[model samples]
Target: MDDKKIEKRIMVPDNLDVQIDDKRITIKGPRGQISKDFSDPRFSKRISIGRSGNEISIVADSNEKKIRSLCGTIAAHARNMIGGATSGYKYKMKVFYTHFPITISVKDKEVQIRNFVGEKGARTARIIGNAEVNVGKDELEIVGVSIEDVGQTAANIEQACKITKRDRRVFQDGVYLTGKYLETGERIKG
Candidate 1:
């Protein structure tokens, strides 16, 4: 017997309360607000904002069903963006200094990883997609509309601390990803 799972897409609002100013839409939410500039007219682009009690809603739209789903996902993401911007999203990373004190810094368009366990030289880490990583003390915040970008960037940061030549059990000193915030899923870490 073939086991198949049926997936269904949820419905989203068609209308939204959009504040237009300087070619950008300021989408206000229950907790906070987010904005995006209107740049594409040729492509199927749509947005809606509405108020319900203390909560404000934002939504995205396209021509196709897949596109609509994507739009709804983006709208939901925008909601989270506003929420995170107001409440803040914090990602915790532990720096294991068993080998050398690892120093991380964001330079130009990439994150530079240096001095891993007193190594002779430092290594470099690449930040994929368009994620904004703000490093504070030992916590790194990966914030963006696309959750995948933030996750990939975080993974890049964590992977940069890996030492291949050393023993896995004894020399486990590296930057580790502790948490991630999802807009539509349960805990993702295993």
Candidate 2:
């Protein structure tokens, strides 16, 4: 069997402070602060943020070659966290009504989906964690620090309108993802 290896890298934002405590990390910026405790033991990540200089470094020590890439992956995730925390992330979706116009609202932190597919009533989208969903002027915006959160929120909203046992070729009427973003509010140029 071949032994795994551990690779390391460092990432820093153009403007932000990154701090690390044990396995936990905290990223601070003008927008807000993002912190969490991660215990995976697969890699070691540390953050240092101050006037002197802000930096996040990752290094992995293992006996297997794969461990190197695994560490790099973990570090990449950490880098993504830094980027997400500093600038934040958002996902945009648009409601498409081919058959019947659907009305969706975000209230009580839960999304109230109504009048989908000309059904009798509507459906509901379950809000997960701190993910924020806002529906304004035909635009659905999903915002959060964690990419996973924003992505999952979009998923929840999309899944809530999913139609099972229906011919997708014929019944193509529902809310669809019209846009996405990387925390800059600028639409994802696709």
Candidate 3:
């Protein structure tokens, strides 16, 4: 039987500090600190993560596609953590409505959507992690040290006002993502 294992390695930058404990990883940098728990049981036993002399490594028991994919995912997550800790992430959203004006507000770690498509009550979306949500008259901004948390919070806000049981052709009232800004000064518009 030929036994071969797949391994992925990440070089820790000089400005970033990493800590790994069991299934959790924490990264600290100039921007802030981001900690995540990779406790999923699917690959916990088959995969291992460790660090040595400014380098982090992920090793899988086998070279199977699934194992390889998981290793890649974990590596990507680590990269994101490092990037977020260094530069941070920003997501911009715009409120659009044809009939009734929409209002957005953030309070108590929750985003509240009022008068969405003329709804009687308000719809709320929970803010994940330590993401900072800024609600403006027509613009919404989410900023966080973790890309996943900021992006997920933006998605949750965008999905909160999903139009349903209405004519899709006529009623186009909803929140939409307008742009994304990364630490590298790259801008993405949609």
Task: Give lDDT per model, in order.
Answer: 0.56, 0.69, 0.87
Q: Model 1: per-residue lDDT, tens digit, 21-106?
A: 53354654433345665344543345444444444444444345544554455455555445433443434465666646677788
Model 1 stretches astray by more than 4 angstroms: 1-7, 13-90, 182-190
Query: Local error of candidate 3 at 87, Å?
Result: 0.8
lDDT of 3 by residue, 3-110 (tens): 589888988899998999987899999989999887778889988999989988998888888888988998989988987888888888889898789888888999
Q: Candidate 2: which stretches are off by over 4 Å?
A: 1-7, 41-53, 63-66, 185-190
- Clashes found in each candidate (C-alpha, N, C closer than 3 A): 7, 10, 0
Lowest summed-lDDT stretch of 10 residues in model 3? 181-190
Top-scoring candidate (TM-score): 3
Q: Identify the superior model by lDDT, candidate 1 or candidate 2.
A: 2
lDDT of 2 at 180: 71
Rank by TM-score, highest first: 3, 2, 1
Checking candidate 1 for backbone clashes, the offending pairs are 16-48, 16-49, 17-49, 17-50, 99-117, 100-117, 100-118
| RMSD value for candidate 3 | 2.2
